[model samples]
Target: MKIYRRGVKLDLSIAVVVMFLLLLHMTGMMYKRELHQLFNEEVNISKRGFRRFRSSEIVDKEDETSKVPSEVAEGPAGTKTDHIPAYNMFHQRITKDAMYEPSAFYIFNLLDELATGEISNVSLFPGGSQIKFKIHFKNGNVAIAKPKRHDRGRYWAYDQSEPFWLDNERHNAEIASFHLDRILNFRRVPPCVGRIVNFRKEILPNTKDEEILSTLYINNGNFCFIGNCVPWFCNDNNPICSEGDFMEMSLCVLVYPSVEHPFQDRPFPWSQGIVESEIWKERNICTEMLVDPEITMGRFFLDLMDLAVFDHLIQNYDRHHFTIVVRFNVESFVVIVDNGKGFGNPWKDDTSFLAPIYQCCRIRNSTYQTLLDLSTDGSKLGNLLRLSLSQDPLAPVITEIFFATLERRLGQVLREIDKCIENYGNGEVLVDKVVVI
Candidate 1:
């Protein structure tokens, strides 16, 4: 990958992995660039990189969790086993409009208020576990909901809000995702309002609800979060919605409209009443920038790569679907969202970046086409990113705040990797065992 960066020939890795990735990305790029290429998207993807902006530097595990008291780790958070539901079983037709329709049913099952946390506005839009819900509290606070774990290891809710992945790495990844989010915020990155969970122990399709929603979790750790998970691909009406034939567990976050809908919630007096009243939107994982409107130029081919890399620095695995809603008066404001996957590896370092999943400066078609569709004034893609690292308002959505956040984060990642390479220690089997085990 680095070789490709230096203008060298593509390596074996790029030939294999990048080629496959490009095949899929290009296919969409071609199509998106066609037909609706005139459409102007508003937001943009972070970035994709070799190791992304994560704290996933492999370290001496022996010195890791061991630092924390054994009892604290072994206590309730020690982790128990959790089961995930089958693919495409939760929401067969993941569409944005449909999420609101089935939400009523899921709300009933997910409003119990567990020991650690409680979600509100429970709405069950169909997905991976046949049940999805928006969790809210009477106090007006909310978190997305699914039947997460109970104190005694029981699944408190009745829907599939838990998560699709339940692996140990993923378990830790949850907190790492948040940690990464905070890390990014340290540099002023608004978290990508998204969610991330495990896929382990998921029941196959046709399984009984008792067996499906019945899946449990032993390690709740950071598996739980309070944000959207629909922006990526999960909430987008997929194969059932599109013409493709894809059936799998998808992670996502919703991207709601920026403007308010007074028809739903009337004008408010004091407080962020209106902003808070507006329902936020999100979606699932695309791993790369698809066709986002905020970005319409530069390596128009793969804008997602830039966003992915930006996310890497934040260590935000869940950026796939989250939000950063802001209020500027009765009707003026901006809200950034999406964080399905952030903070790559919780147990790693700020130096380590993944090769295949690394955030890079490649181009994808969706952004390219979307840019082609935008007027020069409305467009803000790669050129904007370059400006972001230096200026502001290359366009509205692409602000200098975002550029600094992204640039500093990238610098942090490079510095870490530089240290790792400089230190050059030989500890692979040890690191792998600690992470994968």
Candidate 2:
């Protein structure tokens, strides 16, 4: 009996040890899978071939050679070699304190006060459809203000009698674009807000009546303070013309903070040759044209990819040029400005505008993951945008259709990424680092 009991106890002990080892092995496998997902390798697809490297490996290799060559050696005649300066490609990441981060409410208040405050100086800008003014406020703030009355389809660009193109107005679009930029974590767009001001009181005295009449006109017997309308006789009985004090104009103005130094303008080197080409003119160029040489390829692609994603999200196809700001003469970053031409018509799905991402077949891992999360939970992103815009004192400029369009575009972007992953491994398709600087 004692021998049988010993045999049973021995078997039970052996079984327990085997189960413990099995659990440990499964845990280790799960951890390895997570690490693989987190640190996926990036593949650089170029005319030469596809080069794959881990993010850490790339950084280590670049660190070994502090300076990238400014120019490449001579190749066959007319053979183009990307000679972008390494400094231009790589920029140092900005710290929290060093960044010009501000709360939405704070910016809103500042813009509101500047729009309505007593103006010390008012001058016309050089170009654009509407009558834009550079205003200097009593508080020493400066801003560019574009009244809503003079917007497209409401007022003629050259003649007040002729209406501008439909849906050409940009003030509301400008405000909405800024709001979207903030939501996307792209802090490139400057702060803008909408405010209603009496044009006769705020602007008429400062400028010529002829200039004002040419830009601002009466429509439907009412003074169209900022946008276009059918020409109508302005009689004494006309409510807007009769009570001039009641003619309040809605204006979308962007305020500029005083920076120690102005941003340096540098044209994109790769685009210089193709700007006037038939392919560019027709907007049919592929992603291959954007590829830079290996020296600066890593950083250059990062900036280009981010910009491509951002433009697609807003449906802004007018990004021919961008500004690069050199901070402290060492670190630099690209500033995405002039985003007023966005969110034109919600009914149209312009997914072609995102050819860069779809064609390139790669994206930053963080951005890709965030996009997936947002895609799965539709209301989460919409609610976030609503909450942010609702905080603004101005009426909501983003419509329901527009929000739907945004979601549709986002899903399309994710589909493109998924396709890329299918073609190439996830490690090769999804990049880990977007900005080294």
Candidate 3:
């Protein structure tokens, strides 16, 4: 009886040990599964790029014990997915009296903050008549700030004196151009704003004198004096000094957002010198190239046409090259940058610059409709431009005469469109929709 009892006890002990081992294995598997699920929730593969799963989606699938909240996942709804429709992301129909978009307003606010924020770094661009400084803000945002040189009469290679009306107010021109581009529903131009900032004294030691004059172009009227001729200048110092030796001279600057992955240096078929040669133009090689199954040239042509129309409206003829953004080096889209050369003269109309649109005879449907509407009633468009530009820190940068000139340019554009319709018919002259992606 004693031996049987000992055997039963040993068997029971073995059974308990086996159960404990099984439980440990199960717990480990559960822990690993939870980790895998969390990782999946944190990263999602989208057509545009890797986007994080929305907090709601993550929380819905996650265990109750998870720490992340649904509210923490909030971001721009348009950016939630990787595959964004080109038209939906880039195009917005604008009316004559259209107000600024909330997104645009938000950007303007951010730009204001960054401009006022503490400067972390400043570096001068290598070459240019109007010196451009790469400024880094404490908020981790980067901007290219071009100081006001119009009053001082600085000219770049592309800028000619005859376009004297441009006034070299490149900074103001930039902001005005951005507003006009927005009005035209072309989301190519980067958000630009006029900012008055004082340069830090620390930057002076690093920047060259020539670079300072070329880029900053501080004048007697704009500079601050220290003790009867000892100039004490810094980015944030007041232009007028009462007692303090330090004085800050305000620089009228145009701040443009910095893009991370620009195909600025990359060469495309259209960028080849031979392609731009007169021989190629005479032969019309560019137009003759049929659309490839892999890459559609129609989208490129459409974007080019849009850009040309925009340049004509502003009288900017210095678009020698354009920047592009690409995904996986396969799909690419144009990014409009360096538009300070626009708005040359309010009195002059450059019909030659509209050649692309006239020759192509294809405009976006929404753009065409907006132009037609504006042609009928331009007061609203003028009002919208005034309102849009008046919000800039430097008010009245764009005058009423400028708005009138814009209307005249718009009328010319309409005439060109009508001519195209007469020649090619509406079906061919107007592209219903053309998206790059």
Candidate 4:
């Protein structure tokens, strides 16, 4: 009894201090929630940076209330909380595809409306060899549309080593690539959806280009047109025709109306150039390219690794160039803008597509982990892709064989990463963060 009072007093004081700290933390969190609600009312997230909601997981015409707000709000410390939605929300879906942010879901709905949205203006979008149209929505939004050229069952007839330019830029591939981007939780590809438009009503009247107008003709009661000639097979009088005036196409949103956040295009290191040189494939260009002071210091190399994995999954070897968002002081984000060449061949898994991963022997830790998570026997990536694409108005986007091909390619990617890990330890192969100057 003489000294026991000392220990009891000490225990009491510690308990009181712990309780005070817990109360303070609770108050701080409550205040933050109140402030966030006041500023942004559209989104809701939990304390762990993930939100769980039980809305219609698949998009359809009936769900109008779930549309995502396009405007962004400034968060604490001036960061954009909704500019490009992070994977902060969870869907109640069966697969791990539930990881997409809420805004991503909203974008899908917006893209679906492209099929039926009232058209304001349409004109030829000149740049690449493929024919594309810049479509202006009556509501003031603009999109770049790639008309359907290949059938859903079109198989890859060319050899694996054939030049990528020979492949047709498929509209379904563009839409599928966007969904795959969301599935991989990359959020790099812009929002795209498959749209069926009438050439006579939606495109022909709106298009004033004499070159395009001259190419228009009716064949088998379907509206058809051969786009302006480019270096490839486009000028051979092969027209992209609609199935009786209705053509299925992919519409990609045109982000950044003004050039406030302009994009800077950089040529892919492994490209075969205009002449289709074998020099890039014959030797390991990454050996010399990796040593550059600028490449070694920035996040471009890391982005290339991601691109390699992405391209390999979809069997798209035409990554001749990539675009990065350029702005003051901030790190550049790679945008997988042109993906119409993907899904060209579900039968072939091009090893050259894995060059960036194999040669560099590096990959982002987040990407590696996500791929592993999706490749599990129970949670097959292809099955999840099928689930996600099922939401489109033009359902059955790709053949069932393509789903199996996706899983097969994912296994190949895993093997590549495993090889890199075996050659170099995890410390050397797995990058923790995207280091930017």
What is the C-alpha lDDT profile of model 1 across 292-367, one tens digit per residue? Answer: 3222222221222323444454444233222222221222111222233332232222322222122222223332
In angstroms, what RMSD does candidate 4 have relative to the true structure?
14.4
Strongest candidate by lDDT: 4
The alpha-carbon deviation from the true structure for residue 320 of candidate 4, after best TM-score superposition, in angstroms, is: 0.9
> How much does candidate 2 score in TM-score?
0.59
Ranking by TM-score: 4, 3, 2, 1
What are the TM-scores, per candidate, against the unseen true structure?
Answer: 0.25, 0.59, 0.60, 0.74
C-alpha lDDT score of every prediction, in listed order: 0.25, 0.46, 0.47, 0.64
Candidate 3, residues 9-90, lDDT tens digits: the string is: 2233333332332232223443334333222322221111111111111111122322322211223644442232211222
Model 2: runs farther than 4 Å from truth? 1-99, 102-105, 111-116, 128-130, 149-167, 207-261, 264-300, 326-331, 434-437
Q: What lDDT score goes with residue 411 in model 3?
A: 84
Report the lDDT tens digits of candidate 4 across residue range 119-204. Answer: 76888787788889888765445689898887899866556555666878888898899878876777677667776776777677
- Comparison by TM-score, 3 against 4, better one: 4
lDDT of 2: 0.46
Misplaced by over 4 Å in model 4 are 1-105, 160-163, 272-277, 328-330, 434-437
lDDT string, candidate 2, 1-437, tens digits: 00000011213332332232223222344333433322223311110111111111211112223333321221243333233222111111122122223221133334444334455565664444444566655444456765443332232232233321222345666667766665555556555655554444555555553433564566554454332232341222222331343322223333123444455555432232323333444553434344434213334455556666776776664566655554433243456666555666555555655666765666778667767755654334454455444434344556656666777778778888888899987887788643222
Model 1 regions lying over 4 Å from their true place: 1-132, 146-179, 186-294, 297-306, 313-412, 415-437
